[model samples]
Target chain A: MARTVIYERVALIGLGLIAGSMGLRMKRDGLAGEVVGTARSAKTRDMAVGLGLCDRVTDTAAEAVQDADLVVLCVPVGAMEDVAREIGPHLKPGATVSDVGSVKRAVAEAIGPHLPDGVDFIPAHPLAGTEHSGPESGFPELFDNRWCLLTPVTDSPDAVERLTRFWRAMGSNVETMDADHHDLVLAVTSHAPHLIAYTMVGVADDLRRVTDSEVIKYSAAGFRDFTRIAASDPVMWRDVFLNNKDATLEILGRFTEELFSLQRAIRKGDGEMLHEYFTRTRAIRRGVIEAGQDTDKPDFGRGTKP
Target chain B: MARTVIYERVALIGLGLIAGSMGLRMKRDGLAGEVVGTARSAKTRDMAVGLGLCDRVTDTAAEAVQDADLVVLCVPVGAMEDVAREIGPHLKPGATVSDVGSVKRAVAEAIGPHLPDGVDFIPAHPLAGTEHSGPESGFPELFDNRWCLLTPVTDSPDAVERLTRFWRAMGSNVETMDADHHDLVLAVTSHAPHLIAYTMVGVADDLRRVTDSEVIKYSAAGFRDFTRIAASDPVMWRDVFLNNKDATLEILGRFTEELFSLQRAIRKGDGEMLHEYFTRTRAIRRGVIEAGQDTDKPDFGRGTKP
Candidate 1:
């Protein structure tokens, strides 16, 4: 199965789920001639080499991106700047540098100034992940049919197109948006929802009357989904909230207002209002299914889609 | 394929997911000699008969419960009293009466006094359902490996045991608790989570800056699960919030307090506190999986579980 290679060499600055998955998929698709990777954790670096996710496991970010044509920063949002500073002078001339961070504006603000002028800087985010993280949690099919948004702060059409092709070859649908809009969209779609899930799980944990055992045993009653969302990598989510503070807080404020309205309706026995609100939300779920973003089958088509 | 029958006649007073599943399972298992069902909506009654989910379909609640050895009121919580009043005099002496409302204490209060002295009243809730509703939305395996909780206020051990056997035959594990405890437990597990989900989805819907198309298209980023839970039957959830007001409000208050603390942590750039809070909740998700309440497979095990 021969295919056109998108890049001569690819360097991943972090060997976590997204980067590991990128390595596996690129290798499977023969998208790059050589793949080099590194991580701050020796365990992760060792696991990447052992799993054969990359052709070369480098000792430092500077060494990894030395001659790579496509370098991706896959570290937590908070660590992006330091990594960019370390690797800036070592980046190959005319090479494209991108990232898979959740918050775009913050990533641009943190890493943009550290990149060298000759290197093309384009930030991206793949709106795809499981709760699991680290090098061991990746799979080749993690990005199949998933959206990958490119929020390029630099005006480099050729570089952006090249990065888009790489993601498309790895089974992702690519869309480009500005940094600020991407962050706001994500705050609504991912950040606020994750915070709400985390808070709900925390409240359930803190309730003394509802024993931990009871909550765990009866989680199938809709609480289990919240638990699953809240179980995501803590460091990634922490950086997301810290970086996208304004959008997250704004969305949360709106959430609180909506919640209070529903609470008042419940207290006043306003069944009509409650019913209307609940019924309207159902239409959005249908739209998601129709848009090919999610499956409409019962239980998320679990137990059958594979 | 002969098996010992649990009851001669079982009557389901509503034809929604729970009752529809119960009727289908009973017929498939041959646990009841005849299953009778009726719904307030003519369309639902017609669909129940068309699907052959029950052996007989009645036009009225009184007719449905005429000689039923077991009468299960599967109506919304607010309608329990009216259904009980209409069916009370017609229930056969020695019949075991029950309901499948999420709010057990309110259900017991609404339907208890209307029951005849000779009839045993036990309120039960089968903690199993898909987002779909109506008679056609049910299947025989809906209750498989799920829990059916019975909260009986009566002192009839024999009747309780009989009802337990009935649910077990339908592939549900049974547990008995006092009504108030059941209400509180459900408030924590089901009601509050649902209200929060509905609120989050509503907030997304109301955000003018984020187009509905964008929200629907990018829902896989954790918002889709909330929409799935919020897509549940509106009438049923409205009744749940109204009937279980005290416990639901108490849990909501706790959820708001926890959310505000996390919001402050985000605003103050306190990643340490955020990470600690997020990491602790992952353990509960593990507990849920270990308890066999949910699967740990990525994406809710949507593709491989079947």
Candidate 2:
């Protein structure tokens, strides 16, 4: 099928998993007439170009954003401000500035001040990823069927609509919401769960009685899922927790309280309470499946191999 | 591809996921001359027979085990004692009786006293399952490449050897360990992680600020994994926690301590500490993958669909 070009020139800064995937999808679907990508490390840029993730590679964010109609900052949440400052003067007038950060409020705060007056600053977050990272780890289908949340920071209806179309062309369902609400919703859905998973894996590692090998060998019972969540990019996650501190901490506080109550139930042998709580959680799983956010097949349809 | 018959007649005391899977595997491979299954619920018994999980279905455990060479209890850990007393009088002399309960030590204690002196009672647990349960959920390949831990409370080497071969024929790697050690190991790898998942999902559900629809729609961002773990059979998990209280409580205490430390780091904006903790946990994920306990493919190799 022939594709329509959404943007004449699109510049992607910090080519990692998210950016590389965007580059692949945009170039494959002709969503952008020209795609230029850059990263701090020379090796990553080389790899992105070798993998056909971009039409060209640049050594600097400033060099990449020149004359581009759309510039997306795809770096860690902590690095957003630095990239924004570097590329602010280089951005073309009336260009739409956006990002794929996990935390929308923080990204908006970081990039909103650096944009030129005519630039349309729209912050976005794609709620899709794998545990893998790096330019080589990306694929064109990463955004297919997933959500791309847009929190428009500027009064640019035309720019927001165009970006929505661009994301839809890249195979994402687009939705717009307030940046602060987005952060809080994400804290409940993503941030707290990741911290909890990391903590559980860390606890398993620190336990002297259970040897690491034993924990590894018998993980399928449940611990392996926590490990998979914990294996996500460390720098990315650290920046997330730091940048979105208030919301994540709030969710963690609620989680701790709930955990303690369940622990008390276990201590008291309150089977009814435990059973009720577990039964309640199953409905959420069904909702997720019904929402088409996950597969209903057992074990995520993982292949059974000995 | 001929399979040697390990038992002349095998009795399964409950027709749930584990029992049904065992029956399907044994019948398909000709590992047993006949597979007889019994369940308290008539609907479950009918479903098991309709699914061909057993050659025959019995209404009572006593009738199912009569003259059987092998009898395996596949009930909740809390119900082990009553089932043991029910079938104790009918168990054939020299029969090897085992169980598929998650908590080994408690199950051994629940079952050992009721068995006849001539009967060899061995408690076993397969570290394999999916979120779904019941008779209809069973499949022949459910135990393929899974670990089955046996905590033998008997002195008969011949019985233990035969049971070991029986599990191997059903496509599981069998290991024998002390019941206490098995309980502690499982507390770290399964019990504690499950409780943590349950708590996170409960927190998400209770946060009225984030509506249920939003939580379900955006769950792909780490929260969905917790929901899957939390969706497991509630009665089974409640029994596991109640029966394995001490070890699970111990693990939960450690988890709480580690979580607080990380939470403090987040509150203090200690990026270095958070980065170090997250990076350390990545090694465990690699270990789990190398140990073959889980798939290394991204997102457990889930299919991308809208």
Candidate 3:
């Protein structure tokens, strides 16, 4: 099938995993006529160009966004405001400005005021990533069968629909949601779970009785999964918690309450309570598998042998 | 290579994932001359026989263990004593009796007194499993390259050596550790993590504002991993916590302490603290991947296109 070119020119303002993946997928499928990428670090820019992640690399975000019909801020949430300020004057008129930040509300608040009058600011977050970052860590298939959510800050159906079509061309299912609700939902799904994983791994690291080698060797039992989650980019997650503070903290408070109850049940030997709680959670796993959001294969179909 | 037969007859007392995997692997490699299995549920016994998990299915534990050179109690930790009592007299005089329980100390205490004078009791735990459980869920490759820790309670080096050979023949690296220490190590590696996962999933389920369907859909973010851990067999996990009370509670206490500190960092907007903690956890993940306990590929190399 012949692919439709959604944008004549697309600019990615940070050459990290998310932006690199978007550039690769767009180039692979001919979804964009020309992809221009920029990064604060010169090494990342050179790597992105060398890897063919974009058609060209620029030294500044302002240069990358010039004359681009679509501009995406792919930097960390904490850096969104500065990038927005730097490229605000260079953006093309009537261009759609979006982002791939984990926290939508904060990103919008930071970038909303800096944009020019005719540009549409549509905040988007593609629910796709690996435990890796940087320009070299992306693949064209990263967004395949994943979700990309858009929270449009302006009343521009044309731009929203166009961006939606672009994400679908890259093999992502697109949905639009309220920015506050997006942050809250993400808090429940991503932010709080990451913090908990980091905490568990840290606790294991600090324990005096169990050596680090033992923890690593015997991790197949359960802890290995947490280690994977905790291995995600440290700066990205730190900014995520700091930007989406209220929602993440709210979800963490609720998590602590629930954990305390389960801990009490363990102390009291309330086998019934534990059994019921565990049984109830299985339904959610089934839901996730049925939704095609995750693999149901045993051990995520990981290789059994080393 | 021609396979070596470690035991003339091996009896499995429960037709669950571990025992079924053992039977299938033994049958595939000819590790045992005859494999017999018995389960409390007649349906499970029939399925084990139909799936060829064992050479034969018996109606009772005593019948399964009759003249068996090795008898393995694969039931829950809470039911170890009862199963041991039922099969004690039927076990061969020179037979080795072992278990594949998660909590070793409690299992050793439960089954130690029930065994006859001549029978050797050695508690073992194979740190290998998927979220799924049951006769049909077992696969021959489940224990390949996985750690199987042995906490032997008997003085018979011959019996210990023979059992170790049996596990090795089935593709496991075997190690011996003190039962109490094994329990504590497992608490750090598996028990506490499992509980934390369960608590987080439960909290997500109970949040009314975030609908269950939404949680399931957006689960790819990070919560999906926890759901897989939370989906494990409820009865088995219940018994694990109830049996390994002290170690699990101690680990949970430490986990809570670390969680609270991270929570405070988030509340105080202490990005440095969060970054350092997260960065520290990444080293453990590298250790796990380097030790060959987990895959370093992105997302366990799960299929991207569903």
Candidate 4:
């Protein structure tokens, strides 16, 4: 049986939305003994302190993890390895190291080699967020009931269980899977959908005859939904795209092929094909509702055209 | 000056979400002297009567419109002309016939010739609806703070003004514009957005590599928003697609060209292009929020994802 433990000292190596939320949650729940956070900029460190995101804030990654029992690398996926290396020598022996990056496979490979043998390296993703980002954008309830999936290496039961229990203590249901599986699942569920929304917004913006003002003015019927998702943090998403290149590209390839077929049907005025396609798509939405992932209501949180 | 003449023995044709909502609003505000509604099916007519959607309900359009001062056509855009043709001879002289169809030009053009010379025809779109359909789905607050656009061609100013007042009484902002303009605006804001959402869902469904279970799960990031929009009344949307073909196609043409360019940039691994396009789209969402068209808060009505 795994022993129950509250982290004596936790170091969060980023000060953005996810890290801020996790900090707030840890503080509110008293899940960690001491919460220390670091950012690349002194300005960010100051803001994190002002926001009370952690008990201590600093600019140096090594200093933040110097005496920490748990070190979480919540920076961008591309920066995970660099952060890991910077803090590698400073992390206490037998310390638990994890991340909150969206892409799992690359991050696992990138940061895995940087960790000392005594330190644990686990990759995790909290499937919770808003379109907004940064320390100010996060709320305490951001991860209250969301799924937190961990993609850990083989023969890592003890470290995986410890992280799982930690997330559960922070109000998340935990699941463990391989990094590639996590990447593929997220590509379909998160990455492809965001890309599609971003692409659609790009498409609307390209409308020469249809003025952008008109699009903005009348975004009620459906496009507003696309805009909400497209408005998500650019840097986070850009990093996500670049890091999860293989999985995203694979899903995107499939998407484009299907989209081409749809385009042909529309071009040929094949209403039957169009109708059938729409009908099939409708069932998937019902499944989403059934899976408790979506609401049947219009606009989700948005009220009707008022 | 606009007259205060109420619709005497008003006929509400094709009782569904819009017509039922109108009925409830009329009852709450006493907008009409009398309301007699008809439905194609006996069951729907009975539901309208049972829901108190009208003062009276009838199976036949002729019976419903008999001696009515105003007839509001609430059928789907595809069924508008047929309903108009069927009810044309029965409409009394000086009676104004209007509709709440989303598509304006074709609906107006199709129903215009069928009306008697002295009978007025106005095409109106009350920019409103929930995903739920049928008379039971309506409530008095449906039109509250909503927009009701009137596209009239040489109709009696007195009659148009009275209709405008009726919608105002139902708690809507009234605007008068040409049918073409209304269609063009809706095409950008509503029609193309719905189409793209439908297309995205279709793409997801066709992807053999992306399992349905995974798509349904982990959707909170963005895909869930598209699903909600995609869950709108399929038949109503089908009719909308048919009626507003030209403007939708034109906007779609522009959308496709833009999407192709974005796809090319993505394939070339150009992060700047991706970020620039995404960054620009955010301003429109801000504009929408400023316009009070959307809420900045996450649809809290949805509550925390469980």
Which candidate has the highest DockQ of all? 1
**Positional deviation of residue A128's Cα in model 3 after best superposition, in angstroms:** 0.4
Q: What are the runs in model 2 whose C-alpha is more than 4 Å off? A: A208-212, A298-306, B299-306
| Per-residue lDDT of model 1, residues A145-209, tens digit only | 88899988768899889999999988889999888888888898899999999999888888745
Those runs of model 3 whose alpha carbons end farther than 4 Å from true positions after fitting are A208-212, A299-306, B208-212, B298-306
B117-232 per-residue lDDT for model 3 (tens digits): 98888999988887778978888888888889999988999999999999988888999999998998899899999999999999999884556478878776579889999999
Once model 4 is optimally superposed onto the true structure by TM-score, how far is the C-alpha of residue A237 displaced, in angstroms? 1.3
Give DockQ per model, in order.
Answer: 0.66, 0.65, 0.64, 0.49
lDDT tens per residue, model 4, B109-208: 9899888888877788887776667888888877766678899865489888988887887777788988998898888778877887777676666553
Indicate the worst ten consecutive residues by lDDT in candidate 4 chain A.
A297-306
The residue pairs in collision within model 4 are A301-B299
CAPRI-wise, candidate 3 is medium
Task: Give the per-residue Cα lDDT of candidate 1 at A303.
Answer: 24
Model 4 over residues A1-306: C-alpha lDDT tens digits? 233347889999989988988888788778888899999988888888888879988769999998898899989887888998898888788888889999998898888888787887778999887767788776666776678988876366887787888899777778888788888888877887788777777666666245646666555657767778888888778778877877887877776667666556655667677677677777777888787665565435322211
> Which residue pairs clash in candidate 3?
none
Worst 10 residues of 1 chain B by lDDT: B297-306
